[model samples]
Target: MQHKNTIKLLFLAGITMLLASCANDDDTAFTPMEFTTPTYETNLELLLGDTLKLNQEILNLPENVQFKWTTEDTVLSILQNLEYIPKQAKTFALTFKATTNLDSISRTYQVKVNDPYDVYYRPKSSESSSLISQVLAYNPAPGQFINSSFGTPEDAQKLVGSTTNTISLGAWGGSILVGFDHTIENVADAKDFLVYGNAFNGLSEPGIVQVSFDTNGNGLADDTFYELRGSAHADAATLTNYTTTYTNPGMHADVPWLDSLNTAGSVVVNSYHPQNFYPLFITELEEVSYTGTRVFPVVSNSGFTNIAALEWGYVDNYDADYATYKGNLLDIDQAIDADGNSVNLRGIDFIRIYTGAQVNAGALGELSTEIRGIADFSMLE
Candidate 1:
């Protein structure tokens, strides 16, 4: 009986030792370790003539990592042929994404080109209400907003002494937003030259033309900006008083205002308006109509908006018409093929329908800030 009790005691002791060993092994195995991503620093706001520098460093990262860079502005880039110039000052961004097996670090640099000196800009009215009056207040020496639809660049010269944008629209679509570049030897030459364009007949909807100024050289417009849109006003003749007033502040509003650019005149707007434009739709583009009232057809499957604001970059190699007048600007619609592939884009941001596109794809992101142009200050002027 004693021997049997001894065996039982020995077995109980063995069981206790096994339990302790299992508890200790479980405690020792529970060491939590993690990896940390790299760190980078860049100038959040850089002006023209400023050198863009990226101070990058890694922390607790494995070797043999990959580094890639991307940019929203085609004129500026890294490890690519695109040249960097601050002409037509706007906001642009560069993203550096470093990836490793364990972790990744992504950094962005916000660059502002062609920033204007305080004295150069005026306090204009809001964009939503009085587009024409606000734009005119900036340089109200003595000029008229000539519709390029009715006459030639010469006519603009005859009316305002300086031609604004090139003539793009026909007799109905109003004038292109172009200005003068020629000098007269005799002070009496053909008052204006002309700029022709393609997609004139192909466009089902009206086009957009924005007015810009090169404040700080660098060939970019960096200061306050105004937009002009000319849509077919069925009763434009009977309408004598046409005005628009943007009611937002800081260039963004919940209800989009800046989408519909009028063709010079046809529609009337007032100066009391604040800024109102769709941020995603930045380009003063010709509205293309495929089927009906909307510019683009809604995709049935992906739930994308039919009319989308396409992000365009410089096209130096383009051989189309108006290439000279348009310069290296991003000019066409960023459309995806039927096969569900994206267009070749230098840098595209928003993918939703702007106020003008006429289709509602859901809310895409706001367009890059560079395209917003400088805020209008002509009100103080």
Candidate 2:
């Protein structure tokens, strides 16, 4: 009787072990919840006021899972899909979460909303001239002609109606803003505009050109400006968002300037230009600041210092006589945004030109850009 009781105990112990092994196998076979999508990051882009649908198909999640989408403190959607329309141009960070009883998964999306396309058609009137009709703004950095010849806002107006008149944009960052009565179309496979400057064979003071559209129909150049990508634009030496501040020395002296790179320099005073280098028209502020793209100039000193011209895409940059129509021709298709990405602009209503170099050529003084006039190329065609 004792042996039978022992045998029964052993059998019961074996059965219990078998049941535990089966339970372990079941747990091992269970699959963990995970996103089946190939990539974890998603990017969506749309224009402002346009509906962007975020369908559940993008998740590739399993059925019976709960979904939640949130941006900041606001819950965008609790459903499996979302339809969003942005009111303004900005970026939005969105989070999508899927949860079940035992597992959860999440994803992030960056939604970039851009402004709607606004194109200003050219006017049909025969009286409209291809040249710029108005001077919107002018600000010249400290240079030889700041207070003497071409620093004031009124000096920018001289180039409006005639190709013979000229204005000097003082040393680096000096800029002029001008607008046309009609928009200049970006014709395919052809240059769109011409900018006349005093650039000749051995003297080239290139100016960075930027274009803007009247997106709001406000008849103002208050919209975003895109830089025209020049030959040096892709060069690693080129600097973007460069800033220089000029401090008034209170006399006709070397204009001291500090740059964003923590470097310091001066717009050396020359005997030919005895007037103050600092702009005198700006009385409200003692110091002036200017910022834009800066290019590297190749300065060679033989008998005289000569600044070499870039291949193309800059005002006051030398070009072959046949390639120019009394000025340097520019293509509107080369427009680029702040991030160095190319942008397709239908047309432009305003143009801004700024001195792009900051070299002080020994006795020649500071390098400056001189603009005679700007004209729409379609008129010539």
Candidate 3:
């Protein structure tokens, strides 16, 4: 009986020791797993001409780790080697994403760039409601078929100038020089100014618009002028470097014009607008000459044939309608040197628009390209 009690006591002690070992195993298994990801700064400030360097070192990321960087500003020029350079003054938002075997993380950075040139001139606030501040000159000659009143010199301001209200232009090569109270800056990577004209369904009257900078700082418009070439300037149907001469019809005769192709057309007298299309500024001139790009006018059995709206880059396009007008946006980058190479311009002070097409729409009379108003493109945005 003594020996049996001794064996049972030893077995109970062994069982206690086994339970304690199982408890130790449970405590060791309960430890949680941990995860980690890379991080970086979330804000940055830059100047107009400064460059931002992007690399794993700046991010304090581990070596051999791959990451991606991107920005929302189109004006920024990104180098293939990983540099962010802003071309203009604006706030840019950048995103950086990094991933690892265990997890991934993302961060955003706000970059504000300051403009060195600052705001030289503020555009008129009321683009659609504002009238052209000034009209410097008006020149229109009568067409053999197109005879209408160009109004007086005072009336000329209302004649080819831009307005939110309805206005008319003397048919033929009626040209006008319009000015603004402030200069128009050449915005980077964006359109500078917009040309508002009268374009209806299937009928588009194109005009040649030119720009000039106050380079001489003379406040006057005697500076060099650059033509804002339109979309049709390069069309195979267009006549580039073309020249045409118009001889005055005198007091009561038809106007005649001759083109480079020797294809002659007459401006016939129509009963539409009673005012003579000839300019009151110039008279009894032997001949008037026009040299530049010309857009072809369409005439069909149903009336004027529809001129397809260009993708962009032309004034008086189909977008000129009152309901859809968004200023015909033009970029200063489109300017070209006399050799046809691109020319860089800082800003413009004066604007000139001329009747670009020598087209007659039969009963419609001469295609009188009309202007409603001009506005800085930024105003629409």
Q: Among these predicted structures, which one has the highest TM-score?
A: 2
Clashing pairs in 2: none
Q: In candidate 1, what are the lDDT values of residues 121-224, reduced to their tens digit?
A: 33222432111111111110001121212123333233232123222122111222222121101112211112122211112112323334334433323433
Model 2 stretches astray by more than 4 angstroms: 1-119, 321-323
Give lDDT per model, in order.
0.29, 0.83, 0.62
RMSD of 3: 17.7
Model 3, stretches more than 4 Å misplaced? 1-131, 141-152, 159-162, 165-173, 297-299, 303-308, 320-323
Q: Is candidate 1 or candidate 3 better by lDDT?
A: 3
TM-score: model 1 vs. ground truth:
0.22
Backbone clash count, each prediction separately: 63, 0, 14
TM-score of each: 0.22, 0.71, 0.59
TM-score of 2: 0.71
Cα lDDT of model 2 by residue, 1-381, tens digit: 999999999999999999999899678554556655557548888766568787555333456678898988788888877887777678889888778776677788999887755334555368878898999888878788776765566777888887887788888998889999888889898999999988877688999999998876678788789999999888899999999998888888999999999999999998998888887776435888898899987888787989988888998888663145667899999999999899888788899999999989888889999898998988977
* Selected candidate, larger TM-score, 1 vs 2: 2
**Global lDDT of model 3:** 0.62
